[model samples]
Target: MKIGKIPPDVLERLVFNRRGAPRREVLVGPAIGEDAAIIDLGGYYLAIHTDPISGSIKLLGYLAVYVPTNDIAVRGIPPMWLSIALLFPPETDETLLDEVTKQIDLAAREVNVAIVGGHTEVTSAVGRPVAIATAIGVGRRYISTSGAKPGDVVFMTKSAGQETASILATDFENEALKKGINKEVLDRAKELAKAVSVLREALALADLATSMHDPTEGGIANGLAEIAYASGVSIEVDPSKVIVYREVEELCSAFGIDPLETLSSGVLLATLPPDSVQEAEERLKKLGIPYSQIGRVTPVATSL
Candidate 1:
């Protein structure tokens, strides 16, 4: 199973309902892919989002950080604190737990966010390890999944399916060490896996943006479909400009899987004005982040 689906009962028990302190400055809350629930305190607003990593345990810590934090960053929120919850099977080892914690800390460090309080537990309810993180941030402008507008350029960071590529590479290396795929290729794949976080670019784009979407599940194509359908705008993507990493291409070919259709955790998408596109390209360059002009937003019935 993919290990994701908000069950109606669980949703009603945990996510759909909440008891909170009195509110006034709340800006964004309880919205999909919103990352963080934003509460504006006048001078600065707080952005918070929660996420759990289950099936992709190999990169649990990585997704635990970016997937949730990116929510706030896309809305122009800079992460301030992260609260984590880790649940694992009864047989979960201490060493594995330590490694997961280390990865989480490293992810936070990479984005200059702090890991605050959290909970950890081992139970029979699960057969493997799973982690959830609630990321909080500060911002002035608020952006959500429904933030796109007609005529905004839809730009994405990294090629699609970087994470899936890494997985295939790892799986392949274990299976093909006896085959002919070279160590250099395998090493590069690991690097690509670790390079999935997009906090910097997301925050930068939020400074002046229409909307942002991270291509996670279903790659860029599926993500574009979600944005267009959600915001009621049409999108057109140029396959040539979409940047899929060289190693990911090779890996996908090896697995007989379509990289464009796989799940990519590290990809970031932004919709901005056409005029600022060039400057944005330079900014991505300076960050050492690869991107592409894959598509544009237009007024239409649905996403192309």
Candidate 2:
């Protein structure tokens, strides 16, 4: 009944339970923490995911492409094709449509994905424009958020609430300025929008990751909670190790939002073996992506 993602218990009861009979072709089906559905396609696995952008209208098109694509990427697959569905209100103007479609085109090209097919329509079924994208890709190996094991180190890419900062800065600039945030700080926060894509770092670290999660609606806190619940493990995170960009801090402070619990599409949370930490850091540094060792996974205690 919330505006964001459904609660786990409710999802399990209403959605996950009615996912139909298990099929041999479905290598990975619907689950709490799994990013995309993995289907066995003879020689390789097909990773597919769909996401809708209804929260922020300013970046709808861009978010439509990258959000779902990030899901497929976290599965260690390069998204190759996308299908977008654009639904607009009856009063929507032609210029808005053109702008959104253009953004969709530019974003798809930026990620090297083709717009294979999609549907667009203006109807009274919605208040504002909504864009949903489904991304598909093929890969030999896939990683799931449930794969994190005991003794694995938890890693986070970029900073906390990067997406949140960008969204607030872009869509709520006036409110931020009214709250005493300077124009320069707001502009810098807006720049964070371009860094929302985590495909590069996800692919680069996929090989070393036991599990990967794209923190979205609930930021790092929810992402970590999902991984822990899915993997049946306990994760201890050091707050000091989690990096929060200065702009993000200011924006969150202005809005009274907890950065750790805000939207964080750009951040990639992963778990890796202790031995792979050095290699992962090296690869990230070479790619110029900042990261941090935030925590470690441990087995949950059980009564004997």
Candidate 3:
């Protein structure tokens, strides 16, 4: 525990000062904790966001870029460019850095986005190498977390704890096998970890969505809290219908963790039009994506 929290005055002093300027071309400027910004050009509205790697290192830089990219997609946008803020510990190796850069490049290529500019530094301030990427993209009619309607069908594109299970397995392979995780499960874990990008299905449903969000650091439960809070609706997870891998459930039980609370990547939650739900699921199936309908967003419930 922290001995003393940073006082408000000290917290303000410790932060970087933003350059304040109002340019007509800049629709959104430097703001505290605003994950993404927006800019309006003559014919398009561009949404931008950036985030860093903190938890897992196997594909740290790669996942760093996509986490925010998923934000763009969830809001019905297509990511087109990237500007990265990569910080590394002083003892970092050039070869490891190269591998990280290659992963970033390959991932961006898979989504066909250009790497813009940002800072790269090796510093004592950073304990682990951190990759912070700022992504910019275009949108037509953007979906917001606040857009979920009371009756919108709550839909998911993949299982709960997909990335979390995969990351834990990769990070604790030896320990996991002793606990009964097999080759098949391990392979499945790696496959899920490798499945970080969440833009494809999101962009496909962009026009049809009223609201959406990527299930990331805080998992589906946290995601539900946000959507419910923002849209003023209540969502219930039919625990029976939530598709968590059996091994993932076992792993969570072994560690005394809630599978619902584990970080989930490669999944998107959409508050889709009731008329469009089946069509959207079919679209995801046609694209070879795995998905399941878990629940519905009912009118704000008094019971909860």
Q: Give TM per candidate.
A: 0.85, 0.97, 0.85
How well is each residue in 1-304 modelled by candidate 2, as lDDT tens digits?
6678899999998999898787999988999988999999998999999888887778888888889999999998999999999999999888988888888899889999999999999989899888888999999989998999999999999889999899899888899999999999999999888888999999999899999999998989999999999999999999999989999999999899999999899899999999999999999999999999999999998889
| Preferred candidate (lDDT higher): 1 or 2 | 2
The per-model lDDT (C-alpha) reads: 0.75, 0.92, 0.75
Tens-digit lDDT track for model 1 on 251-280?
777777688877777788788888888888
TM-score attained by model 2: 0.97
Lowest summed-lDDT stretch of 10 residues in model 3?
1-10
Candidate 2, position 2, lDDT: 60
Q: What is the Cα root-mean-square deviation between model 2 and the actual structure?
A: 1.1
Off by over 4 Å in 3: 1-35, 302-304
| Per-residue lDDT over 1-304 for candidate 3, one digit per residue giving the tens place of the 0 to 100 score | 3432233345455642444566697654433222356677777888887776666766776786678788777767788888888888999989878977888888888888888888889999989888887788886656667777877888887778877777777777777788777778777777776677788998888888877778776688877777787677888778787777776776666656687877887888887878998889888999998777778887876764
**Which candidate gets the maximum TM-score versus the true structure?**
2
Error of 1 at 231 (Å): 1.6
* lDDT, residue 91, candidate 1: 80
